[model samples]
Target: MLSYGKADVRNASHLALSNPLSKCAESTSSDLATSKLHTIIDALAFRARSIPDQTAFVHLVDGEVIEQAITYRELWSRSQSIAAYLKAFEPNGKRAVLLLDTGIEYVSWLFGLFHAGMTIIPAFPPIGSRGLSRLALICADAQPDIIVADARFSNARERLNDLLPSAMPQPYWVETTIPTGGPDCTGVGPARDDIALLQYTSGSTSTPKGVILTHANLVSNCENASLWMGDIRGRVGCTWLPPYHDMGLMGGILQPVYDGFSTLLINPGHFIQKPFRWLSAVSRYKVTVTIAPNFALDLCTDGISDAERSTLDLRHVRAIYCGAEPVRSRTIERFTDRFAAAGLDPATIGPCYGLAEATVLVAGKPVDKPFVSFHVDREMLSRGTIQVVDENAPGACPLVSSGRPAAGVEILIVDPLELQIVPEGRIGEIWVKGDNVGTGYWRNAVASSETFGGTLPEVDGQFLRTGDLGALLEGELIVTGRLKDLIIVSGRNLYPQDIELTVEETDSRIRPNGCVAVALDDGERERIAIVAEIKRSEKLDDVAQELLRRSLTAAIVAAYGVKPEHIHLATPGTIPRTTSGKVRRRAVRDALLAGNFAQYGGRTRAPVPADRSAS
Candidate 1:
């Protein structure tokens, strides 16, 4: 395998800086034309007319081979066909839902709905039992007029209809297998402020909220994201992320068209089954920029074999944005160290912060420098203060900075209870005010006001109250944890992600990045309880369970001096996760409260002495 040294990292950083923000520096004439183009419909038409031959999208089959590819002209023609068919229905401000999986037709329907002046609702195809129920709930909420579904998913449709039961009127279904051989679209498109899409929340915290995204909001978000991404023109992007989610939708699908670049889309299941396919595609296709959550980075580090590493050439790759979950410094460091021999630049691992309500990009670290982090006192961090400490010091916690605010986005750290701005460098709720902020949730004015209509002590304009907890240090944003996910134990704030990371690091039998920490109440005080998923090979026995619990409790007690309530060992995939693959701690708590959990009752063993050098 090829190995890259310090020179490689420096060269990659310099290369990224050389073309900084070239996309934003368009010619004045083109900029004026772009300014006049408000909706994505306008952007698509512009791309098709100006760069008809430019490759627009490539869908990787099995995450390895390019099975579907489309150019801007072809995409426009196919979408026009769908639009003309839809126009025949006279869709007067109708809400249309997309139930097809991630592929070329998905993109066609996306633009076709916009071209037909219908508000788009992007929903993941109903897959599992939960998928059916969730999709039913989404349909019930939106009450969409038209549903664009894959003809191949007839069985799933039957299950969905059975679940929803016909008490509700059936929506007009548009099967994807049907051919629409019609003329080009002739109707004028929607205005900038008109409703364009309904981006539902991931339901990670609660029921998924239907966020109303206007065309103007999306255009603003794309422009600001370009300024954050910098030099994205001519850069090829790729992702195995699902297209319905916020990061995948904005970064993978929309951002490419907005910046006039091509992107490769991979099925997420194939990547999960074989992560090597992701990097293999990047190596084979010369992908320059890609996006994935932090777990993907860890999977590549541990799952990819040395033989696989020998096959990759990553020097052409400049940035791999890691987000959508708590960004762990250990994971980033391990991935960089593991791939340095494959010409991977350590500085190319960019830790970012974003949310769906804010349109997927709020802050991203500059790509011109090496990644940086702050080692702070963990106990003090929980108490709401930033206290830098030595890396080798006791109670030292390393936190990576998520970078400064993106262009045109204003951030304020507001104390959630008082609704007043907190002082700089203090943990508080992140309130965002920007053009990218969606108008509000659909048909839910109370939640819209509670989350989107944020008002500060002296601020005049409305701000989107992001439920994330973070702090500003040295002008960079450092996200700590979710406000709802925080577990208070005897007055100390314990972040579940921090504990979950530690639990995974404690043993090899425990699955990496598959632990959930929740607060257990003993009436008088709340103690930390862990639900850890053991590796499938490590089957659960009486002795194994006892030793695992003892080791976990010992490590945690040494680190935080708190005994665990109980450690529940789950088999692989037993723990519940959100649609976007984040752990649902609230759901775990709900299950525990409902007594829907396994119990391992044995004689309580005395805790062993903790390792002096535990993480």
Candidate 2:
């Protein structure tokens, strides 16, 4: 069995309400009051009115700072002008596509559309030429009457127009000041059921579906989330999540604005190229709330230099929500330890769970409690049993619970086929139905009917079927794996993460963090292939490869009674990841299929020599 360090003498009990600092509420009064229309608009206008002179947005582009802050009265007046301008351009509540990155213009553009009662299609600005082509097709499908773009997107707009000049309508660029001669508009919008924004999903190629979020849906989610976060309105937050994403759009912008909170919004490119800037902004602004995925923590810890650490102080960060991907226990521990020297609170790193379908949040632990991890057997876990094991067991990886469902939401584990509820601690497909559940996708009836509609069973008068596989243990939701991510091999199921984790812990020679487990097909038999990243300059060549193969074989044989087809060693950081930090395993598998490892700077060497193989 593999060895492990002893557990520290820290407390892991359930957070008590008696602890004034604890934010977890076992029994919250489920009074999710609807946010009055007048109150919400008044609140937004109030911020501008109160701080009309203060800065609303500060842009640091190409090493230059451009500031724009409008008072409430000025913002309202400008919005009226823009609304009039837009109505003159396209009368009625026609659609307006926004092709701009996150900036002051983005806000004005949205406010103008809202003011005009027109649908807003938020397109990612940095999508460039290729993304623009895809976006044009999406627009064709959306068939928007008009488009609003900034100067930066002129090239993309021209390219899209060139590609489909006849089909695609002409777009109006918002370059000069807000317009003045259009229909006069004011007051609360259409009914709460009217669509406010059409958020497009990621899979735009095979099936492009935009979620239709109503005013009530958006308002309810923000109000509920505000209740969850203790509605600390007026607090300052720093965000770098892309505006196109649900998390960035709803959580980063809508939630803050609805609750009257001030936030420092940064673009995604800034975060990807230099993650330190994200942290620097938080430290500089003394931000109290921030959210990011798991890989962001890994990048921050791996990329930050020692010299940069001296200027960092994270003491003011009260709560950090981590979701969008699997929450790695080891990664968080290392990150917390690294920042602890700068007075960062380990308890503030709140591991959360949610998805786009559920409006971005399902459950999360209290901010005051440090993360909790359950050590379970990897083999038994794949069999739908969460077999608790000793923390130091050789094949044990701690599974983090995403806490209980939020107030006004109910989540349950059920059999995907049978539709019957599963017992506690037994893995099953997760099914949820609540006010937080979103309306069906835009125009894709087949997909919407199959996934979000009532094809699945109902729970307490609400439709269900989450597509996630998890179990409930001790009254908390423990997501084990994805129902669709299981790989069928030789009449058995193998989880890629289980094998990848095994490889990382089996041998010390392999790059600890850069390893992936993928299945390889030889046109006859399918076998598992372990692609591990080796530290450069670790010369052994074939010897290192053989050692990895043998070590992985022993570990698998002892744990799952299986052997891999091959063990390939690669350079560190070769695996591609999504914008939100999820490892793009299919990309690596495709590279292996096309035999492009060598071209990709990977070592094309054979396995280790027989004699050099590990015992």
Candidate number achieving the greatest TM-score relative to the actual structure = 1
Residue-by-residue lDDT tens digits, candidate 2, 171-235:
55555344453456654234566666677665411344676666666666776677777636335
Taking all chains together, each candidate's TM-score versus the true structure is 0.91, 0.81
lDDT of 2: 0.64
Report the error of model 2 at residue 548, Å: 5.3
Kindly list the per-residue Cα lDDT of model 1 for residues 1-615, writing each as its tens digit.
111111122233343453221232122223425346788777777788877877788776556643567778888777777777787678748898888777787888888788888898888778878888999888888888888886665567667777674778767788775455665568645778889889999888799889999999888888887777777544888888998888998999988887777788888899999999999878766788899899899889989999999988998888998889888899999998898888999888888888988878898888666667999998898798777899999899899988888898999998899878888778999999999999999999999999999986568799998899998888889898999888888788888888888889989888888789987564666766688877867666788788888999888888776777767777667678878998877787666655465443323223221221111
Output the worst ten-in-a-row residue range by lDDT, candidate 1.
1-10
Which candidate ranks first by lDDT, i.e. highest? 1
What is the lDDT, from 0 to 100, of the residue 329 in candidate 1? 93
Which residues of candidate 2, in runs, are more than 4 Å off? Answer: 1-35, 38-43, 46-78, 89-93, 126-130, 162-177, 180-183, 187-190, 204-208, 231-234, 455-458, 490-493, 501-526, 529-561, 566-599, 602-615
92: Cα error in model 1, Å: 3.8
Model 1: clashing residue pairs? 21-231
